[model samples]
Target: MTDWWLWMYVAAMAGGVALFTRWRADPRGVPLSEYRVAIAIPFWSGLWYLVMALGGGRAEVAGHTVYWARYADWVVTAPLLLVALMLTGTHSLPGRRWRLMTALVGANVVMILSGLVADLTTDGTARYTLYAIGVLALLVVYGLVWGPLRAHARRQPAGIAAVYTEAALLLSVLWAGYPVFWILGPSGVGLLGSTTTSVLLVGLSILSKVGWSIVDLGRLRALSDRGHLTVV
Candidate 1:
């Protein structure tokens, strides 16, 4: 695999770990646990898209791979990871986590349908436009729904909401940039810009994971000490 593919794999694994850690720490039990699993869906899907984009090469699929087309899917799919992360954290949809999940599923379905149509129709401009629409849909969902929910949740202590919200917002910004780059730039420039943006996002993801891990460790230590003191 290319260096880009390797980096993508690393980013996915790191994000998965960060997400799992937060899920485990969630004291609310099943509501949050289910949310965690929901969050994993997009992370895993995005990872698959990343691998296909970077490593699938010119392999034929149904007579034509549409290599660049698959990358457009990757761009659309990547934002879902942030959305999932936002939902899993304290920023759950007020009385509507399931509703948000449904919306996410619907958004993904539209994206897939549009992608297939674009692929079969072999309309490059339409494909790009459809992918751009998908990206916009995700942004609106995150900003209007998930972001507000998270902001409300952050009123509590433990800093979980704040950390996760910051991470998700950072990721959302990165994901949103890809389509903007494609829409505004010259040929080949989008690829360069997208790849550069991915690199930065991946780097920030690693740091975010590290921070979360550290915080989790501190909490674990405090709990352990509390238990020991009680025994003493």
Candidate 2:
């Protein structure tokens, strides 16, 4: 069952690469930067899932088997995902976005790093403390995305704004599940068994990475077709 979910993740990512490549071949008006960042998300994710599937990327942390590679995957891909969303939101306006982008990326990194440390810590107090910190970091990420980022995106043309809304909503909701799963899974309170946790995480990864990219790119392509795409 674990192999099934692991390979499923690999296959989903491979499919994302192919789908994006086909769309990128003739990008119409979508920026190459977007395509590159979009492609990198799934590419990195697929590689890490491949690593996990090959019987590596696991560590015995706090008496639980932690897939550290998943955190490694998040450290890389999560930033890239935010970058993609940042590009989408600021497709026409880039000048004032760097600050928000920095906050988003910084908070995201802290979230992933803290989660990793929490996983590795054996002390219950330390582990939960780090988990709280990670949760706070995630809240910061959410505030940036929904507050400042969404506000900026709304200033875009209607098409671009709509795309940003859909993409941002999709990403935000999917990401909220990660911490819940973490706290419930073997890593936290062990309310969820490892197998169930792995399956759930695999499902979330597929949506947040592969599924979200497809929606983002597809909507952007539509905007391009409608002459809403700007060279940013």
TM-scores for every predicted model: 0.50, 0.96
For every candidate structure, what is the RMSD over all alpha carbons to the true structure, in angstroms?
Answer: 7.4, 1.2
* Tens-digit per-residue lDDT, 1-232, candidate 1: 3356545645665565566556557633233443454445435545554565466523443344334434443444433453445343543323445555566556655554554454454456776777666666665656644555565556534444554555556555544554454344322223444345445534544433333333433333344344421111
Lowest summed lDDT window (length 10), candidate 2: 92-101
Q: How does residue 78 of candidate 2 score in lDDT?
A: 97
Evaluated with lDDT, which candidate comes out highest?
Answer: 2
Steric clash pairs (candidate 1): none
Who wins the TM-score comparison?
Answer: 2
Tens-place lDDT per residue, model 2, 128-197, is 9999999999999989999999999998888999999999999999999999999999989999999999
Going through the candidates in order, what is the number of backbone clashes in each? Answer: 0, 0
Whole-model lDDT values for every prediction: 0.47, 0.91
For residue 50, what is the lDDT in candidate 2?
A: 97
